[model samples]
Target: MKISTLITAAIALAATCPATAQETKTVKLRILETSDVHGSFFPYDFIERRDAKGSLARVSSYVNRLRQEYGDNVILLDNGDILQGQPTCYYYNYVATDKRNIVSDILNYMRYDAATFGNHDVETGHSVYDKWIGEMNAPVLGANIIDTATGKPYVKPYTIIERDGVKIAVIGMLTPAIPSWLGEKLWKGLRFDGIEKSAKEWIARLRETERPDVVVGLFHSGWNGGIENADYTEDETENTAKNVDGFDILFFGHDHHARKAVVKNAAGREVLCLDPSCNAVNIADAEVEITLRDGKVAEKKITGEVRDICNEPVDSAYMAHFAKEIDEIKGFINAPIGELADTIYTRDSFFGNSAFTDLIHNLQLAITNADVSFNAPLQFNTKLNKGKILMSDMFKLYKFENNICVLRMTGEEIKNYLEMSYALWTNQMKSPDDHIMLIDERNTGDMQKFGFKNFTFNFDSAAGIDYEVDVTKPEGKKVKILRMSDGKRFNAKKWYRVVMNSYRANGGGELLTRGAGIAKEELPGRTEYESKLDMRHYLAEKIKSEGTIYAKPNKNWRFVPEKWTNPALERDRKLIFKR
Candidate 1:
């Protein structure tokens, strides 16, 4: 063959062969996430019945600003708790039913890419949340929530999003403590598996099956601060990043805190984790860069931070969008139901039995006719002024959705319960400077400002029983029950019906299991009855029936040792009330 012929043949072969693809430029993808919005779809607080600081309107403004600047490669996500809390969702959930739920409509309008279910979302009952699942335009991912029928995830396990030829996989998981906080009926037909285990299994599966370039875990949980609980931590976002591999970023919720940090994953690669504070108060902004070589991902980088929406103005367009519905909800929540004969405040309840807590106790006893009532000031610092009581006051009084639960307990069991509660409530009066509230400011953090070392919601007190909590005594010996309200001597052997909320009955605060020494498994069986309606609803009806209420403390319980407690009370009052 001629030399020219050989050259022509070589050129033809080169033309026919596939060319190697090479990177031309780097691609920047932005991700925006909102967690634990808790039904704050609008800026208006339905309970307060006024415009508020945090809402989707403000978030919308922030998102709009980003879109205007970044040009729409932004992926938006919600980490659940959207179906409960706030009066907006409550009206939609139970009152007027719309074909397209307002929450679904709002999130759809916001253009959420994906979301997960939180424990409170599940608490809205299957019918309510199922509606959200059906109406949502985005994928609701939950790798650990198993459907009992099929033994597979009740929702989509994970979703892969491709942007500009870059494949990004987002996996979602809920905290496994659902059963511990909510009733079985609320989460019926579903099981929440461990976060770490689910992340491990799904990471391997996604790597093998999807083989995406970037993986993100959208967790409806908290950052556990390197804390471990059995196999899975309570808010296992941090732990999952530490123990699991293949995740590039993690977004957390359910604890209502704003935080951002980087942790080393199992592969020793940096994983960016962020939690936007709840109620639309904040948002997480994560920027990811993908470097490509030969048209394949060579390196990836993620930087994340939380942005405050407090200063941002409410999006006028969003406010105008939901104006009509907001007005209707306002009317319902603001209507006066009855009158408050006297003013009551929660600040007095912390020091001793006061009119604030006794009102709840009286309502519980009158409704259930139980021998005794166990009550707590759900509102940490709220006041119901004398005069007309509006429906909004009900929400202020009881912050959670709890049903009245009646349980059978003996005198000794009740005393044990009180002892455990007081131990947590008051510190031993060993010295004069003991800081009467049992607060360790360093360890308790900002929680001290709420007038308790722990969550003020868990500070339980009893009614219908005469007792004294001697802070001078040790933990086990602090509580001394004098007698029952009916002049009967408290008998240890006789079983007495006690009234409390379903949360405690179902081991919510651990008072029953840890304090009363009842096995966790036996809590459901010990419940004699449960209110058909929530306690809030009952309170409303009671007020409506009476027309006017004279709220007063029964004075059944007090702190002993007047010498120490009186002075301590005055000091603590100044500390808490700043009066």
Candidate 2:
């Protein structure tokens, strides 16, 4: 009699239950990600002063259309590196601090579900990013970023969302390589942990606690460790997704290379990985379908792709909404700063010294009063035509906001640093026709596409010292120092003060650590001085004070075996520069 009563109760309960719960339920989730969007907020470029090929304004149309169809099922995510690119951000970051940050207003307007912090965001310093964190509508997550005093995560580690009763959890982590790239003052009160370790721990904890159906890993990191070892793994994104379980999809950036792939984890479960290159050029998207039987998840399918935002038409409404702010930024960037005597080309830095790279080197030497200065061509394949120089032109001159540093180093160490730089920069030649630039052979053409074997921003050159790089000699034997530029006796054993961007002084390029044989931990003690603001600030001030300026190369260094190097250089130059 009691069993029969229970059956009657069950039948009655089933009759009153929602019809959808009784049937096989399927929920489709579209996860969209934008990574390394370094301030291409609008459809215009503040520095270039032209219509941008890709911008968030154009992406807004795509995003709005998806959301209209999918509603809340369309989950929008932003992987970091948003705080530092165009004057769009720089204006709000510094110029207009009295109001809420424009980035905050922009992200909130777009309805981003959650965001992560990139190394560049942290480079904005505590005053900037800390304020940005408070203004964000959604959580700014960093699972591996630990607070020293509290011994816990600094930002929200993960966020959970429910779409049609399907639980989706997204965990965020930036590169643990910040210490190697940024100064301590920028990332004060926080410490970074290895991404793989943090990933494994968080996945297990979330499984035990949240029991989410889908897991996503959003990382502002690269796919491979480049020229760095023993200190930290710069690119732990792939390793974490391959080795760790529970992650269904992973998104990464920071190298600004776009790709999508599927890899099997330790449990032999497939995990989808994707990244959109920087500057809103592309957006990473993933489609997932979950089948539920009897209220239990039965099966799941996932696929990933990168969509081009360049061709998308700008959302007129979106552009109109930010019109006032856009016009203000335009006025600021276009304001004249000074006059230039001659045009400068960044391509010239590749073969030898050029006015483009030397302008920065000269500024660093003058600002720090150091005996030697090291600089690199940050803005690759760019140019500044000789004429009235605007504030925007200054940005083209110095791409990143990096602090300048003065360090005490022996003459021998400086040469060794150059040796390592040249090793990554140029190739040894045997014949007059042999290539000198280290072009990536795996690319379409060894020299046609101009794809270097390494990052061009890391190709460092020096001023204040006269040196010769022999193309015929091997890597270590290429550099030979004579007298100083001023004709003073150069002693290899003597120590001299050197000026360089904080990125180099902090071992961002591994020039000082791996090349000079200085341990990564010991770099802090060698620093004699470091600028409080970016070197561009001083450059702008100097230019404004002078009103007019002449730009020229130091011409203190050159590649030897010119007979052999010259022919190859010209050949490669034509292929790269299209001359």
Candidate 3:
């Protein structure tokens, strides 16, 4: 054959044959994260009887758009804390147990790739979370959570997701400090490991076994330097992102703080860390571009930001899909419970004695019939108006579903506990004009949303004891116990039954551990009595049986040196409340 003919035939065959597939391909990943949702599944708030600013429904609209834009590359993940907060979670968690939890339904409907089990999810106890997990379509990842019965991970430790030949390994972990807040009964048969250690171990094993192009860490704990107990801290996000050499991107929640940060790992690789805070207000977004050459990762670039879900339009389809459940929740929350004889405001609880904390205090004491009751205001500023008290009003009265507990505490321990509580509660007044409330300088803003240095929920007051708080006095010397409210002599050596919430008895606010000088490990054995039902249940029943609720402050405690404290209280209240 002629050379020209052969060349023409070769060109014709080349033109007819299929082109070579491109080995250098670019895969774009849009990682959308929702953390600490806390049961704002719908766009409405049953507790407040108002529309929520942001919720999963609004988020669903944006998530749908992203799914359409990126298709299979859009990965949806929840960083836990989905089982508590609003009335929806409470009702589904304990009240409406026969049906599927709304949380599980929302997550499954949104088609979450994975989710972590948060401490609050454990707060619902095994019966709820276990069932919820089984109902979810996606894997519930918890590398740190170990089932003591099987001596293995209670859920999937990590999940490997593949998109366009690019593999992504996601390792999920929770804070090991759950025991510090939740009682053993709630988190029974399971133990949580330190976040950093768990992440490192999982990353190491994944590297050894699976060859993933990208590694993602989905953590339920917060960033560094919080709730330090024993060797590990409550938030290991920073520690793990800095020291752990494997993870390319890390997302953490549980502290309920919105943040987007980058830290250089020990290997000099920059790792993106993002926390979208609580409520469904924000969504953490990470955009990753993977360049794959010959089916292997060649170059990768990642950038993260906090997306405002409030800006997203509410998804009508999402809302309509679960309208029945939403109506049921509303009906359950709006049901008539009893009647409030008079209004009780949480604002009054901040200064000295108030009807808000007293109501809970009385109920705690009544529930356990303990010698003394310890309580605090959970909500920052809210008032339950006079007249009808609906079932939802109970949420305003008592925030969480913590069980009533009575601890065998010595009188000295109680005094020390009160001292710690006041130390965390009030500011050290150097003079009459000095600010009385401990303002958190780091957290202060134009709104001064939360001026209190510590969480107000930690500021506990005694119900059965007459005591004085000298704001001028130092921390240890501030609280002076006069006597019991019933005119009984308070002996420091006497063993008194102290009634409080399970959160306190389990060392949540550190009133029992740090304040009373009792170690955390020994707290489980200190319980004298623990109520089977939540304190709110008893309160609801009590109110229903009585037909009318009448509660007022007993005025068992007061701040001393009225000359300095009285004026200071007024000034500080204005400053803190921004009135």
Candidate 4:
């Protein structure tokens, strides 16, 4: 053949054959996640009645920017806790009682790709959540939550998304600790399973069934324990990632923490993990660079980051779109309930006797007419300035969906219950400089540094007994019940009716079971009465009927050894109140 013919033939072969550039192509697939949002769709803090730091509106701004930069390959997911947090969620759940809640509407508006149920999401009860599931445009997922009738996942376990010929499989798992914390009525007909076990099963199934290029774990749990060998629980997202083999990225929430890291999975392969902190405060971002060879993934590079949304520009279009709904929520929340003759603040409740908790205690005693009452400051930080009280103020006073109950208990049982309350309330101080609060400072650090060790909802106190908590004394001996508020002798053997919330009656905080020596199974038998309406409702009615409410601490309890206690209290109070 001629040299020209040979050159032409070689050029033709090169053009027909797969070139180096044709063999491989890179695609940037970004996954943006919002976990434990707890219904912070608007930037407004409904409780405080002010503009707040975090919201989906703010996250939407970041999402819009990311979409602009990355285009159609970006995926958005919410890690749950959406059904029951702010006033908007509360309004829809209880007050309005719509077929499709505003929360589901808000999520649908945000165009969530997929979501999982947080334990709190289930706490909204079956009626609300069941209807909510129907309203979502995106699939709501929870592989671990099984329907009793079908013996399968109550919701979709996972979703497969194919973007530009690249298949990405996302599996969702919820924390299995719902049964431990919530009543059966809340999570009725559904059973929660362990996270690690569920992930292992689902990951294997996804790989075998979907044959996806990438697998993602959308876990509404925490990154705490290492693996399933020694540690196992519902809040084991980290354990699932370490023990499960196929996942490329794990987005976790619940326990309301913020973090980002790449850790080794069961096969000793790097897996990206991201946690967006609660209340829409941050966005967990997983950016993946996938190198495709012959229409399949050849190389995968995953980078995780937590982006703080504080003071960030919010999406004005998103905010404007939801303006009417926001206004309706605001109108509903701002309606006057009654008037407070005096201001009440939650900060003072940490010091023992406070007007804040006394308000709750007073309402419980008035309605139930029980000989004793126990209540806690549910809000960590809130203040009701004197004068007209609105529905929003009622939420700040008692934030949970708890019913008040009257429990029949002996004086001895009451003492024991208070003992447990005080033990968790204050630590036994060997020295004045030692921590007054039972805080894990090493792991938790300062509240300013690491946030509160315990949520303020758990800090309970007695309101019907004249008692003293001697911080210097040991745990069991610290609570000294001098007498009843009516000056009756505190007889240990005599039976007395007590009014407390259903949470305590059902063994929340273990005060009744562990402290009072009441069997967990036997707690239901001791309840003399239980309110159908929530405690907040009763409080609101009482205030409304009277038109004017006087708020004052009964001074039913105090910490003893004022010299040692005073200094420690002062230091600790300053430390906690710094923020």
Candidate 5:
């Protein structure tokens, strides 16, 4: 039967049913949300160079089936980060001459109702956004993102949908930290206003003008915070660090954590908020029942559940088709361009090591031939194994499609970058009495300790450079340059080439990338080249060449212990790294 016919019949049946006998007119609004997708349309992982869990085909089947059952009552909304990650992004940016636009195909299939902007989404710059937004079936909304040139919101703040005689208002908001966190170039002339102020204003307008029976907030602002001076508080219910004065339900993204909670506004009214974990790892299903009296909603009840997508059975046909596609792309995904023997973890505390971080530093060194290399640890979704690593694995490791670039920096400029990175560590260390102080005792009073240090090491190179960071001294004071692996100290007067992602090269991480001290040179290759290289293909080639693989640690980097180590270190170590 046609979808229109199905929708018509469902609406008629719902209307004919006796409202009083049923206690409430039952309308099932199935909300299917995907946030921070970062262009993983298929189930493949670029770093692992193999098919991992999570496929858009499978997600499509689930969404389509639900929509068929509930008709117009079902809304599919993506919470942003649809761009970047995977070969899809790489192909669009580099190889695909026509700009095949992979996301367009997925959106056409899902028929998304709306989406919010994510930090990564802005990294592509405004031109790419304008092109993609024009192709999207749904509207991209964020009331606070103003185009400085026009002094107007980049997208509508909210949109109202009439589903089964009920008006549902969906509002969107991006994180306010876009400028500070992502850098000024990507944002350029854009200005991000406070989310609370934008939401309150839009909510009042939505209520006064549209009078929506239910108001739902679709936000990429992420859960509240544990970080100091964080704008948003970590509230399970509202998800906004600031209070949510309006909106009955809120769906949050970013932070990559799942939570369900109830939040109260200034008026002391309760609100429901839900956030699902990243990847296609989990899905949140929210069903709200609104009771109406004399054409107005008298009361409302909400029922929500989060389902593990990986645990669910995949549609056989969809899986088969995806498997075939993987086969075609196998050469690209499985190529064994690199090897590893030890597991790599991205999360770092005072003591733990990060293989991913080490790999990126190595890549920077190799690519730029710089005396010292530096990179920030990316919070990827999962861990990597010690054997034949594929491109797919790298894709999951750094999902953002950041381009790699080389920059020439003086010794003083390098010191400044170290200072910024050090700030993150000092800020994280909460108590002074803590053991494992960031700075070493010998270098405590040296003003030069306020600068950068460097060393070299051999760890898994997800990107392929090698460097070491001395964690014994206070953050800014600890970076020491041992040897460039090639035996070179970056010259302050003469230019030194340092490889970094375009985002970092452009000073994306609030890193100093401009002025007399720094000069940038763009590399023709894609920033996420390793990730988009087709890990499956790489892995297949690895097996063809060698049977098994081993990853060894490059011990060039070491840390000095301080007095403030976590007391629960032993227990916590088992809990964190025992996979």
Candidate 6:
């Protein structure tokens, strides 16, 4: 009787164990993401003109290894800005015979799952984007971008992928400000809708129809403070909240910030949002582990880690491929255009002034034969060294296909433009001790209202002119001409022949249209041509033949130093400019 009872118990235990085993299975999914790649696929640094960290080859190997570990449970994605940077961009724009799309080749090799569009991606104009989308192996997703002509969406709003028996929904969103930021011609006939509304509708549809186990929001809208909006006032902060209603994970790009935060929607539920820094500087990896019960996920666990891709070993194969491409493009960039003195110019400095800006000013002045030339110190990819400049270097300074345009403006208009710069420049100065000085009217919840903090201008002696800046004085009155290289002072009444890019000539930059009145002319060539012409070309045509470039200070513009009388202004000015 005892033996029979024991046998019955053992048989019952065996049946229960098999039922439990059938119900539970552990599955691991690893997600590897890159956002705003900006054509830095090869390990070479365009600025330094040498081997730097972060190449598609290295990135590929890492992803390949991750895939090997997790098998089919790995997803590789790029958040956008893939079409414009370095050798890949140049080849696609100029040299490609069939326009095979260099970026597509690299991405196809890496096997990207999905990507959203970035504002820079639109800079190449619509035709390139159309070709890129057709060439890509993965689907491009952006719910907000709509065609004005057809009144239809350009790409799919979301995609459903099945991995390891798990249904995952992925949705993409481009920043709504792209239309305004990139301008109409580039984003012509396209409307960017509100993110919240578009996301809500898509999420609702995904949940109702697809019933995905997990929902991810991939976005080109970045975090606050990193990329400030154009119109940030004292009280407004840029919105960084991801209020997508029902997303489990949100991956972001564009702002070039690496931050991990949790955002809550109107429904009082939490969503995890993550953004990694740019330039393959670092990588963010996340894993989701799910436990199944009766073929359904009964429990989920999320773990994330940030890896510095630069420290890892460079993949030899991809590195070799990149080297070959770099060598091919070398001759195109290295052909000596001109020579310069032993001076270093850089665009990275956000405060005070830059010699690089001086070079641009000189170039514009020479190119357009303008009396007063101006250029915004845009932070391009390269840094100038003490010797001869290369063609690759030119590409780094000017990446767009923008042309030069000359416009006419009145003296009053010029003064107004200068006044705008003064207001923007001085307002950024704040005193930490005084609450009133620091109180920003543009605090829009997610962004700080420090406007034009990185403004500076400097002149090179060989380039052309000299101007005395009373840094202590208020901005509008600070600039006074001391002397030009030709020993002359500036004359406000004189109609100067100024040259600038077509974008800025047409008022692309704020407060830079002051000298657009006397006469207007459109240069036949684009800005890229002017930049590619190099110092050699410019000197061969203008300065070298003339033997010197000179600039003189104009004392006509003068004002009292605000720092001497206003204590608050003095304190704020000192504090902000301390760095």
Query: Which of the numbered candidates is closest to the native, going by highest TM-score?
Result: 2
lDDT of each: 0.83, 0.88, 0.87, 0.82, 0.58, 0.58
The estimated TM-scores of all candidates read 0.93, 0.95, 0.94, 0.92, 0.70, 0.75
Q: lDDT per residue, candidate 6, 251-364, as tens digits? A: 776766566777776667666666765776666677888887787878877766656677666667766655666665665656653445545444322223455555556666
Residue 358's lDDT within candidate 1 is: 92
Q: After superposition, which runs of candidate 1 have C-alpha atoms over 4 Å from their true positions?
A: 1-22, 225-233, 442-452, 577-579
Which lDDT value does model 1 have at 308? 84
When superposed on Cα atoms, how far off is each prediction in RMSD? 3.1, 2.9, 3.4, 3.4, 10.6, 7.5
Residues 516-571, model 2: lDDT tens digits? 88887788999989887788888898888888878898899999888788788898
Q: Which stretches of candidate 2 lie over 4 Å from their true place?
A: 1-21, 441-450
Put down candidate 3 lDDT per residue, 50-131, tens digits, no spaces.
8889999988998999988999999999999899989889888888899999898999999999999888888999899999
lDDT of 2 at 446: 18
Whole-model lDDT for model 3 versus the true structure?
A: 0.87
Q: Which lDDT tens digits does candidate 4 get at residues 1-579?
A: 999999999999989987488778999988988987777888889878998899999988888888898888999998888887788888889888854698778778877888889877887888888888888898999998999999999999999888877899988998776765667888888888888788878877887788999888899887773212222374687777788889899999876667787889768998889988788988998888999998988888988799888878988999888888888889988899999899889889988789988988988898989989988777666799999999999888887777889988999998888887777678889987887877655435221123445444657788777988888899789888899888988889999889988777787767787788898778778988988877788988988998998889898888878888888888888877773
RMSD of 2: 2.9
Any residue pairs clashing in model 1, and if so which? none
Model 5 scores a TM of: 0.70
After superposing all C-alphas onto the true structure, candidate 4 shows an RMSD in angstroms of 3.4
Q: Alpha-carbon error at 551 in model 6, in Å?
A: 11
Which residue runs of candidate 5 sit more than 4 Å off their true CA positions?
Answer: 1-26, 44-46, 49-51, 97-100, 181-189, 226-242, 316-331, 334-363, 377-399, 405-499, 505-556, 561-575
Order of quality (TM-score)? 2, 3, 1, 4, 6, 5
Instruction: Output the TM-score of candidate 2.
Output: 0.95
